[model samples]
Target: MKLKKPIASLVSVVLLSIGMATLVTSPASAHTNAVSATCSALSVDLQLYAASREGSPAEGYTEYQWTRTVVDNAAWTEYVRYTYTPKKHGKADPADASSTPLTDPSHWNADNKTYDNSAVDTYIHSGNGEGSWFWWIATTHEAKTHLETKWSKNEPAGDGWVKTGDSRFHETSPAVEAKTNHVAVTIDGTKVENTDFSTTFTKNYPFSDKYTSHTYSVVVTAWDDPMGTHGWTFTKSGSSIACTPPVVQVTAVFPEPVAPTCTTDGALPSLPTDQTGITFSWDENNSLKMVANADKGYVLTGATFNIYEKPGTATGDCYVPLEPVTVAPQTCQVGDGGVADFSGGSITLPTIAGVTYTVKTSGGEPVTITDGKATGLAPGDYTVTALPAEGKILTAGETGWKVGEDGSATITVTVGASADCSVVQPDSKVTSTEWADGTWACDATTVKQTREVTTTPYIWVDGAWVLDTAKAATVTEKQTRDLLASERTVCTEVLAAPPNTVVTIVPPTCTADGSATLANGVGYTWDKTSFGPGLWTATATVADGYAFDNGSTYQVTFLVSPKLTGGACSVSQVLAAPPNSGTFSQVLAAAPNASTAAVLAATGATPLPLAIVAMVLIGAGVVLQPRVRRAIFTRH
Candidate 1:
């Protein structure tokens, strides 16, 4: 029973021991295999700091410090070393025993001395029961020295170096705290704020080791002020001081003003007035005279005497002074006195039947003459005189004239004749004896007579014909004689020749009756004779009383023209009547017999053959007219 108990206990012990060993070892083995598996799966980023060599100190030395970040696993811990070496037991041993110091193996210098471990192996084991293990180690795996370091020691410092406290140290020290501050900046006299300010610190000692210094920078944010802030306070390192802000300048803007001027409307005023006493004569009559009251005064500056008239009126008479005539002060006042004279008054005789009167005077008291004349003159001839009262003398006076008895005031006159009247009577009268003879006696006609008479009669005023009463008469007369005898007897006795009187007669010619007739002839009458006789005379008188034979009957002739024969006859003829055809009878004379009468008749009747033949042919042609036409037609 004791043996069984001991054996069972031993078995139990072995089994528990084996089970615990399996549990622990299995986990360790799994962890190691998982690490190797993770290393196999991860991408290996190999960075070398230095070549592998014998033992050396890993101070102030870096190989992969400048390299980029790479993926690493737990297997990467083998590459961390102080120095580099080769393999051990047919496997790489990055933590080699030969790279333990950083000094030379053959010599030693205390001033520049480093850790010396030359006498060492060149390889190191990596598994259980290997050489002494280190977290970082240098390697000499390829017969060359190499260095490796921790990743944190060989990274970039964040905020770079800065000036700080009494001792310079890496800001990563746990004893130091970080802070934030600001700096000021200005631009063109305006301010800015909230500029980023930062700095860094590093260690003073550990010359071979590098420390990340705190870095400071300005981000330069903007502000409302034009000038900006570029200053920093000692916030993180607390070592910076303050400074004065920079200055800037500027200018301003505005506006300006203006000026003024003056002007006027039109031309200036003028003046002209008449003088009182003095005859202020000028060479030119049209000179301008200053008026009594124009404006106050003349603006002679910048003005010329353009023209002259009244103020504000363009057209009055202008009297331009020969020179500039300045009026004496107060001379134009009212109630001033002056004088002119008219002294010597004289009369003159004109050469052309007229009169002239004149005043002869010189300068004296001012006075005028009243009405005055010279009297006591007659129509014959006279002379008159005049005398001036004061301050004068007569220069021309006496005159002469030729006068007449007529009532006229002229210096010369002529007389003319007066009117007269008269009557004229016949010197002798016709006698009674001449009237009693009973011929064409003008005295027996008893026609009243008149005479033209003229006389100058005077009325018995104061017993004589004084100058006012002369008168006259005038007459004229016409008379006629009466005849008591027959007109033929009167013509024979008074207007005929004595005994052998030869008379001219114009006989009658053809009339409308186609024969000459005495009733169609013109007749005449005569005046009575102073001595009686029985014979009578006649003449053929035209309707105007002109005798055709001119009262001489030496030969009697008549002109005749045939009248147109109408009624189956047409003839044109002219003839003349014989002279002395009418019978003349006187008392106690023998009668003419037939033979004498035939002679007389033959003489009186001379046949015109053309007229006779024209009548006869007209009668014959009228009788044979139809037969002749019939004979002509038969012959044709």
Candidate 2:
């Protein structure tokens, strides 16, 4: 009997990553440029650290826990996020008061979104309330919150929490202890009436969303004092040393889904997962065959499914005789005297089910049926179709029997069976393009490029032969991995670089240059600064095991070039080398800065000798000086 409601449909995922968005948990970063020039009057540099509370639910339980808190330094860090730009001597003119620089010898200011310690950041646990008393108490039914904040003029609060650290407020706080040791009541640079008295921060719970997936922005604060007792001794630029506070963001993800459960309830147990038991194996005749898991006692309803298919592409027509008298069994051809293959090339195997056979007359001649089955037939020739209780119908080929044939005429079927499909490639490469175990290769018999395994599987369960997708056999997969072909001795292509720079690449060729090559990373440069314009190339003297595609050769190309007398190039111009390796009209063969006479008299053997060229140009210019022309013109 079919289930009243499909179990698969009833199963729903409450929490979905449909849109797994990120919640910024950390505070907007604070910037500070504040460090007192001298510590003479600086009271102390105190660092207060606090942890952001984190909670998680126990597996399979509804209650959640505040396992531990991650420390958040930003709570106290924001107060002194002053940019410390010290004055030449003491402090800037508007020191500690104005944000910008002033000429005042000992003055400064801290602006730029400075923190206001005067007011408490009440909404520190903004939006999220996991650690808030309201949220925690709601779940635990507690009368009061265990967490506390307070200040005191008494000695350090020591190990135990102070119920009432000070008359200022009856609360538990870190600053309760530090106030005891000091002679003067001083926290940060602000002095208290008594060295004993110090103030602290307390929080009032704000309303938040009910517990669920959320981004909680909570800032916890803890105090660290040189006294090392307790209570906060917060300080600023005027009283503290230079320090940087780190900002960290924390995010929470929904827990994983619960595993499937099995119970004695009327509902069917979960179906077999992953087509582990369904398989197929071809008999000698290549007729349809299936190997699968039996339903045994687990099946509530019996399983019966049909397999339908046509001949494979290789076979033009599907026809396999039950007894091949005329043709060899192994080499039977399609359209021979046998049952033809299924219609769609392959059988559509459903969950395991019985395949029953019935013999009916080829043509429609009213035949009597008994007990909902074919019986008592005086047959001439009849067609037998394998009617699977579930999927498709399998052809049993045509049969001609005597009027009084025995049960041999009865249908044969395996109660529970799915598609059987899996193949094994030959250990070595083969010339065959398509083999039973699907493997597609490169060369006719050289390399195997890809291999695959495909199948459809089913397992018997809950009595009925329903589609066992979970038990379906794994489909075939094709994969091509790392291939080994020696690297060719060639450059792949030119790369981009800075102005006036070019690169040449040499592959670690297979067997051409032996091992004389460098380790693939060493680069060589040709100095052309003083040598006038000419071709320049950089080569590597190292060799590495990296391989290249196709047959390439040692190659050189320009990547960067600068100021071209004419042409579009990337790198800055190298005076000596030709901009690129091609012949062109009026290309500067030599450095343009070279002397004019040097170009006129330049030879391939040598560029103009630097010393000689300079002297020659200076001496020639003196003789051509125009002042001498005045005397000559006057004589003429």
Candidate 3:
């Protein structure tokens, strides 16, 4: 019979000898001295067959040599039918049990004269269980015994399956294998140091099962964080990513960074051709930096830049995003050997002839402009103007221009100066002559006269010459005169008579000088000191005369006393006294001699008788005049 083994001890067996008459029998003989005894021992023994096996459990794998047996000490050999039962024991009867021959039979023990079958039920036990086997034995008599065997304390195979996927990536529900991956173990709710725990899971497989993919991608990546509203981000491959526990992947994607293009708010004259033409990077303050490549003699002016996020990108490890800012525009002249780092590649500024402007009588602030259009302007009648630069002029459009409501106006500026204007004048000449005032000549021949002349004046107006009537003087004349020699007045102090005729002699007086007789004797004595010692002049007219004309006038000049000689009574005239005629001369001759008259008159006698006697003596031609005068003087 098969026996059962306990958990902590060896198996207990209950053996009975079976006596069946209607079954196949071995022998039917009994001895009188032999007592009827039942089989009492039934046991199961275990032995280790192999320590390890293929496809074993992750915790531990084992194999063992197993044996089951039943034995009795009596010297009777019999046939028994044994049956294995998982639940019941000792119910098999020899009348109904199958009498199949054993694959391995019992052997006889010579020392004890006993029989035992230890190899009756032999199999590999992979798990722990409780089992039993029943047996029916036929002895040499009619008595029967039934036996039951049970066994326990067999070990189980494994805990469960385990996982063996890649460790670089994590999944929510992971794949596993038996006892190959670290599994958490916990007493209550707390975990322990249990990485070696495992389970038997059928879904665990290799990681390359999903690696074959199709897409257009590159190793280079771009990062962005516009205004730094969010953290840095970069675009990754659709087949690759990073993760934490409970998930894992093996393929690594290393992407290089691509250069971003430079941008501006205003329009540029040229654009970059490639990445090298304009490069965007970071500065020492982690700000965005842009550098450009420019040609010779080119310059950058009035260009500004700001940071912008590259769209549709995820942050990579090597890239960082910066805050948004607008970089101030810079001016760099490549011709002056300066760097074009502040500009984009190949910058060409728009040409503006004149940029200065003004608002005519408008007090508003200057308006901002974009592409020559005024912006932020209020609605009004705005007169927009374009002012010229230094050393230039508004030669064409000097007048103010009006702008439409849309602030649209065309300002044409010309750069130049205005024209010039000047002149020269003429010389003066003589015109006429006239007589001078307050002059003596003929009667009205020294009269005053008038001369006349003319002149014209001009002025300049609006680049041309015109008559200046307001400043022009009227026709004017000047007065002057010329003197004549015949007009000079002559003055005479004394008049002398002709010599040798009878005349009366005027004796010298106290206030007058004496005068001598002339041929036309006239008694004329004058005071010489009346006029000063100088040339005296007077206009002379002829006195009334018998024959000479008296209507004409002439000039006479007299040399007064001391001017003529040293004598006080001396005088001279440049012209003779007027009125000299033959009758006037005869009158002078009729006069007696002034010396004779003076001699007779000084005698103080009767002049008629004496004069008659003197005349008879003078007429008697020979009478000595001195003798006659002596007689007369003696007689007196």
Predicted structure with the largest lDDT when compared to the true one: 3
> Which candidate, 2 or 3, would have the higher lDDT against the true structure?
3
User: Mind giving the per-residue lDDT tens digits that candidate 3 earns over 509-543?
Assistant: 22222221222212222222122223333333323
Highest TM-score: give the candidate number: 3
Superposed model 1: Cα runs more than 4 Å off:
1-448, 453-456, 460-469, 475-489, 492-514, 518-636
Write down the RMSD of all candidates, one decimal each: 58.2, 52.8, 57.1
Ranking by TM-score: 3, 1, 2
- For candidate 2, the per-residue lDDT at 119 reads 34
For residues 1-636, could you state the per-residue lDDT of candidate 2 as single tens digits?
Answer: 366356534443212222222122121111111212222222222122332233343332122112222333323232422233433533233323332223322322334444544333122221233321100000122233244343444433444444442244333432322212222223333443232212222222211222111121212123223432333322222222222222333221112222322211122122233432222233344333222332322222222222223322331222222310111111112222222222211112222234443444557454443443443333134444334433222333553311112223222221122232222222322222332222322222222343344343333344323344564444334444433343112232221221111122111111111011111222333333243322333332212322223221232222111123324444332233212222110112333354434433432223321111111122211211111000111100
Residue 330 of model 2 has an lDDT of 16
RMSD of 1: 58.2
lDDT of 1 by residue, 210-285 (tens): 1222222212211211132211111111111222222322111111111111121223332222422112221254
- What candidate 3 gets wrong by more than 4 Å, as runs, is 1-408, 411-636
TM-score of each: 0.13, 0.12, 0.16
